[model samples]
Target: MKLTVLVDNNTYIDQYYAGEPAVSYYIEIDDLKILFDTGYSHIFIKNAVSMGIDLNAVTHIVLSHGHNDHSRGLKYLREQYALPNARLVAHPLCFRPKSYENEYIGAPFSLEEINRLFCYQPAEAPVFLSENCIFLGQIPELYSFEKRKAIGTTIIDGAEREDLCLDDSALVCRTDQGLFIVTGCSHSGICSITDHARKVCQDQRITGIIGGFHLFDTDSKLEETIRFLSDLSPDMLYPCHCVSLKAKAQMLKYMDIEEVGVGLTIQL
Candidate 1:
């Protein structure tokens, strides 16, 4: 499997690709071309073109959650590529209307528009997109330190309720070494997501993890999270997007954390 960072919150000093406070990863596994979480704007498209990646060939577009930063790029993506054959995969609630403090923070497209644009696959259970890649559906709470937290309100059946981000999920790629996890903001909690990935894949070893951890302050939760990750001892960790530098600094004391940026590529 190979993965390319099409959009991220940072860019290396010499690398000239665009950056945004968002996430978008282009992954190739087996014969499948998957795009995980479009960024907040058209930056993903620009970065992809710079990387010489043909977005039109993407076979699957998987959304990590309904948050705008993770999913709003769909509007820009459709403008350049038809992607008639690609399938849209995400939790059923990922396309609903969501807001935080009276500001929209959901996918740019609605469920109806998504259904009309591509082959939509609403999955609440783990679904294998390829022999080595599996889209982890709704993550279950597996850790006490990392519990589901509400970010905003989402409309369900015409009623608004606190969004626990039940739609948030991740993708796991199985390899000889272990599992390589690709996630969005990890509103579901990175440790919880990792545990769920291990349970679903039935593998204890994790080779690496990339994408947002949503950890900010260097609080007790960060300490416990670092301990939890230290126990797993994954080969590498690339926590970006919503993860704060202070949290990254705290994590650096215990584990290997790679710097993620646009134009970064990893082959495994």
Candidate 2:
């Protein structure tokens, strides 16, 4: 499997790619071309083009969650690089109205609009995009310290309720060494997502993990996360996006974190 960072919060000094406070990865596994998250705008598309990646060739689009930073680019994709045959995968509730601090943070397009753009595959269970790549649907919060906390609110059946980020998910790539987990802002808790990926893939060895851990503050949760990841001992860790400098500093104390930026690529 080969993965390319199309959009990230940071850009390499000489890479010359556009950077945004968002996340998007272009992954190629076997004959499948998968796009994980879309970032906040059409910037991902522009970066992919610069990298010689053809967005129209994407076979599947997997959304990590319903947050604006992750799903907003779908609108640009639909408007410009329309892939009518591509499969759009996400949790059922990912399209529900989401708000943070009384401001809209959910997907810009409605479910009805999305259905017209791609072959919608709303999954509540693990869905395989390829023989080795699987979408971990609705991660289970198994860790005592990594409990789900309300990020905002979402409307369900016309009733507003705490948005526990039930839609938060991750993409697991089963490599020869172990699983390579890719995530968006891990609102479901990075440990919970990794644990769920292990359970779903039946592989205890995690080779590496890339993408936002959502550890922006130094708290018990961040401390617990550092502890959990230390024990897991993945070969490489790329914590970016929603992760703050303080959190990264604490994480660096426990594990060797690889630098992540736009134009970065990894092979497994």
Candidate 3:
């Protein structure tokens, strides 16, 4: 599998690609070309073009969650390219209207519009896009500390209710060595997501993990998460987007963390 960072919150000094407070990754596994998340705006599209990646060639568009920073780029992608054959894979509630403290922070397009545009495949169960790549749907809270906390509100069935981010998920790629996890903002708790991925993939060994952990402080949760990850001992860790530098530094105390930025590529 080959993965390229199309958009991220950081960029290498000489990479020249534009940076944004978002997340998007272009992944190629076997014959499949998968796009994970879309970032905040046209920045992903711009970075993709500059990185020599053709959006139109994407075979799958996967959303890790419904947050704007992770999914709002769909509008720009639709305007700039035509990916008629690409199938959209995400949780059923991912397209529902979402807001945090009265501010809209959901995907730019509605589920109806998405259905019409691409081969929409709403999943609440693990679905395999290919032999090795699987979308972990509706991550379960497997640990007591990583309990689900309502972020804000979401409109469902004409009624607004607390959004526990049940739609939040991640992608697990099975490799010869172990599982490689890709995620957007892990509102469902990074450890919970990893546990669910292990359950779904039936693989205990984690080769690596990339994308946001939604961790920002040096609290008990962060310490516990670091311990959990340290136990797994993945070869590499690329925690970006919602993760703060302090949290990264704390993690570095126990495990190795790779610097992630736009134009960065990883081959596994």
Candidate 4:
């Protein structure tokens, strides 16, 4: 499996690509071309074009969550390519209206609008995309240190309540070495996500992890995360997007956290 960073919060010094406070990854597993989490705008599309990735050929568009930073680009993708055949995969609640501090933070497109453009697959269970790739749905918050946190409020059946981001998910790829977990925001705790992936895939060895860890501070959570990751001992780490510099610095003290950017690519 191969993964390309189509859109991220940073770009390499010499790489000529747009950077945004978002996440989007173009993954090629087996014969399938999968797009994981469209970024904030057309920036993902523009970066894809720069990398010579054909968005029209994407077979699957998987959303990590309902957050705008991750799903907003779906609108631009539909307007630009209109990939009628690509499957749109996400949790059932991913389209529900969500607000953070009185500002919209949910997916820009409604369920009705999404159905018109692509084959909608609302998965509450793990869905296999290819022989090696699988989408981990509704990660369980099993770890005590990684406590469940609410990002904002979400409307369900016309009632507004705290959004613990039940719609958040991740993608896992089984390679010869181990599993490579791809995530966005990780509203579901990163360790919890990995643990769920291990349970679902029945594999404990993780080769690498890429995308937003949603770690902004070097607090207890970050320390616990470091401990967990240290125990897991993954071959590579590319923490970006919502991860802050201080958290990265803390991670670097214990593990080799690789650099991530818009034009970066990884093969496993």
Candidate 5:
């Protein structure tokens, strides 16, 4: 595997990366080097070192919720990347208290500021960061009609949240070209995060499904999310941060779609 798109929202308009948006994404299976979510600041560490990407070889940092353009790039990767031991597979209530109320608001910039340099492995459903990846937490809603709406549930400095408890997750690999979904904004509802990553990576074939499908999909959640991704008939389907454009034209009207922007690159 090998994925790039060091930041998105649509930019990388050819001609050598013109303009930018930075939403972060930089996976690389086998000797893994994940870093899915850390944009909107140092612009995903300066477009991931100009697309050569190697921020101290991050091991993991899969946070898909606690919005703020996805954890506000942990304040420019705690002041210009270095990792020292990067490991932050989220879902321990994804740092509680969120916002988006009157539109795009937030909370989650404490804990001495994201532990200064990330490392908080809290999960809920499936853990394992190796043996062929797997970091999906709290993605156990099991769709059945997907419904998770917590745009912003406040109450900090004393706990108590409303539960957008999104703690969103995704990162399932079984390679050799099979189940390899890796989201960060499907927000626990991209067919219930690919049917809970095929029942916690029991795997059954699903080659690609990259990041962010969050745009509050419609048209029947985009026709039951493409009939559950055409029965996991994956083979590549990378979306990007806060998917929109009318929920990706209702998921490209049910299949065939790929475009993550910002230095887009992918392999498997």
Candidate 6:
């Protein structure tokens, strides 16, 4: 399996490009091609094309959550490419007329916006791309400390949402070597994602982790996360997107890590 990062929150200082937002990643695994999230805009498409990826060839678009930065490029992508049959997999609430509120200026996408963007396909559920690849829809929260972090709180119709991370989901792949997990923001909590992967794959070790860890904080939850990962011991850690520099530094201390960003490719 090979993974290519098309967009991310931080580009290597030498690989800088203007207008791209905090994070995004495009991954290629065996014969399957997947875009984890579309970045904050159409920039992902531009970056992918510049790097020799043809959007028309993508077979699946797995959204990790519903925040604009993660799902915003959908409209542009479908307009620019020909994924007429590509399966878009995500949690049922991904189109929950939501926004990110507490962490930053949360911009909840209006239902009208979703309709205009995806041409209005109702939120999809667990979708299997291949025997070895699967999308875990509506991940069952299974950890005490790993509760969903409060982000993107929005008023849907009348009620205020405190845990509106309904758009969160995780993807798992059972490669010949072991299991590989690709997440978007990990808003549902990283530990929960890994648990779901293990449960679904039945005793497969998580060999690699990629995409936004949602650890962009001064008081970020790295210490506990490190302790948790120490038990799982994934072979490699590829931190990108909302992961903090401090978290990356700490991850290196615990396990093998590969820094990733736009235009970079890795053969796993």
lDDT of 6 by residue, 239-260 (tens): 7777878777877787767877
Candidate 1 residue pairs that clash: none
Worst 10 residues of 2 by lDDT: 109-118
Which lDDT tens digits does candidate 1 get at residues 1-268?
Answer: 8999998889999889999899999999999999999999999999898889999899999999989998899999888888888999999999999999999999998899988887999999999998789999999988777788888899999999999999999999999999999999888889999989998899989999999988998898899899999998999789999999999999999888999989989899
Deviation in Å, model 4, residue 155 alpha carbon = 0.5
Error of 5 at 89 (Å): 11
- Model 1: residues with Cα > 4 Å off, grouped in runs: none
Clashing pairs in model 2, backbone N/Cα/C closer than 3 A = none
lDDT over C-alpha atoms for residue 77 of model 5 = 80
Once superposed on the true structure, which residue ranges of model 3 sit more than 4 Å away at CA? none
Mind giving the per-residue lDDT tens digits that candidate 3 earns over 81-176?
A: 788889999999999999999899999999899888879999999998988999999988877777888989999999999999989999999898
Prediction 6 TM-score vs. true: 0.85
Higher-TM-score candidate of 3 and 6: 3
What is candidate 3's CA lDDT for residue 229? 94
lDDT of each: 0.92, 0.92, 0.92, 0.92, 0.71, 0.72
Cα error, candidate 2, residue 32 (Å): 0.9
* TM-score winner between candidates 4 and 5: 4
TM-score, one value per model: 0.98, 0.98, 0.98, 0.98, 0.32, 0.85
lDDT of 4 by residue, 1-268 (tens): 9999999988899889999999999999998899999999999999999889999899999999999999999889988997778999999999999999999999998888877767999999999888789999888888887777888899988899999899999999999999999999888899999999998999888999998999998899999999999999999988999999999999999989999998898987
> In model 1, what lDDT does residue 229 have?
90
